[model samples]
Target: MSIRHCYLQALALSTLLLFSGLSLALEKPIGPAVLRISGLVTQPNMLQQAVFDMQMLQALPQHSFTTQTPWYPEPVKFTGPLLRHVLAAAGSAGENITAIALNDYRTEIPFSDALKYELIVAILMNGQPMPVREKGPLFLVYPFDSQAELQAATFYNRSAWQLRALQIK
Candidate 1:
């Protein structure tokens, strides 16, 4: 083959290989029972207390409570499913869980809290969705007012706000 033809052939072969690799990379990664709970409406069945998406969270029976946080001055109304419900959905029975936020912030919570305490994943506040600045979408909260033991700073730190993911390990 002439020099120009040889160069064209090599270019075509490289392009084919690149496209093939890109296709494979674009394929979804396997493993894990990934459930998306965002943009789904909350409902009011017994199962509603279990696994739920964001839209479902909004639709479910609403519970509102105003509480103060270190991040804010005035108390904020928190609404969402009980933490126990979320744990049950994940089939979690471990001692620790890693909660990740949309911004990649993460914290670890004791499994005992979910199993024994009335912690909640607050999806709303003051009858409105929680924006990122307001610690919205999802906020893990312990009944600090009801349970004095839960008012400690350690528990407060574990009460991750703006939560997006939960991995029980």
Candidate 2:
């Protein structure tokens, strides 16, 4: 096979996959689900809602940032996918989101916040998986250190720990 021929074949296959909607597929979670997103989402084969295991969240583009939070005494590095990326994967250009915690705490966040800030659904803290007692499994955190305005009461209140679900609207 000629190199040019192989290149042409590869391009054709990729174009076919893209047009067939294979490029937009989101697989069913194989591990235990850690989070659920519903209301206004358009995930493949699961329009209106999506379940995400730890690995599913990790599969998105990952980002990390260190910030001092009121919940902690020192600045700690938080690592996970950006909230915007998660929303994109769910096919939601959301306007409002209700973040639900494991203990039933709920907070309303404007979707614009995700677009404006480096908000993250944090899976790891300080290079280690956060324990439940330490506010883990999952946490929605803002990049407080990145901007002075983010180090405020409003952002802290929106930073829901033990985050379990996000209801987009």
Candidate 3:
């Protein structure tokens, strides 16, 4: 009725829409789910896990870099959302992440890696989408060439490929 009431109503509606959008972001994947994040998270939608389709991850801010790795003979381009952004989207609040690959190869990645290193949840390699056989739909990659400290077996083993799930602990 009054101007104050109208303003309050508009604010309420906007707040409702904002929360609705967040809920929609966690909706079941339209295509196959590329990754699942579970444990120590604020949001869990699918079977107590946040399941992400390729498009969902792609929607985040993309980061790309070319670097050499033990697996590759030459510098290769890796592209995907930053690990921190992905964790934030999933509402992950943990000190460490246990990355599990398709082959059941698992590695523990410190949460600090997201801050200390420009880690990427790599969706593409060498400008091409990685097939499951080639270590894709997802890979956790560190910029080994960018930082000398990351060029060791410890960091190499922590770079999980064919990443299927992440459990925060």
Number of the candidate with higher TM-score, 2 or 3: 2
Give Cα-based local distance difference scores for all models.
Answer: 0.57, 0.82, 0.82
Which run of 10 residues does model 3 get worst, by summed lDDT?
Answer: 16-25
Residue-wise C-alpha lDDT for candidate 3, range 1-169, written one tens digit per residue: 4568545534443454355343324556788888999986656668778889998888877899999989988899999988877776676656689999999999999877976788999999988999998988899999998989999999999999999999987
Worst 10 residues of 2 by lDDT: 14-23
Residue pairs whose backbone atoms clash in candidate 2: none
lDDT of 1 by residue, 1-169 (tens): 3568545534443453354232211112133212232211122122322234565444434455666766667776677767655443333344467777777787888766775766778876777777778776678887666667776898888888777766654
CA shift of 51, model 3, Å: 0.8
Order by TM-score, highest first:
2, 3, 1
**Candidate 2: what lDDT?**
0.82
Cα deviation of 62, candidate 1, in Å: 4.6
Instruction: State which candidate has the highest TM-score.
Output: 2
Better of 1 and 2 by TM-score: 2
Off by over 4 Å in 3: 1-25
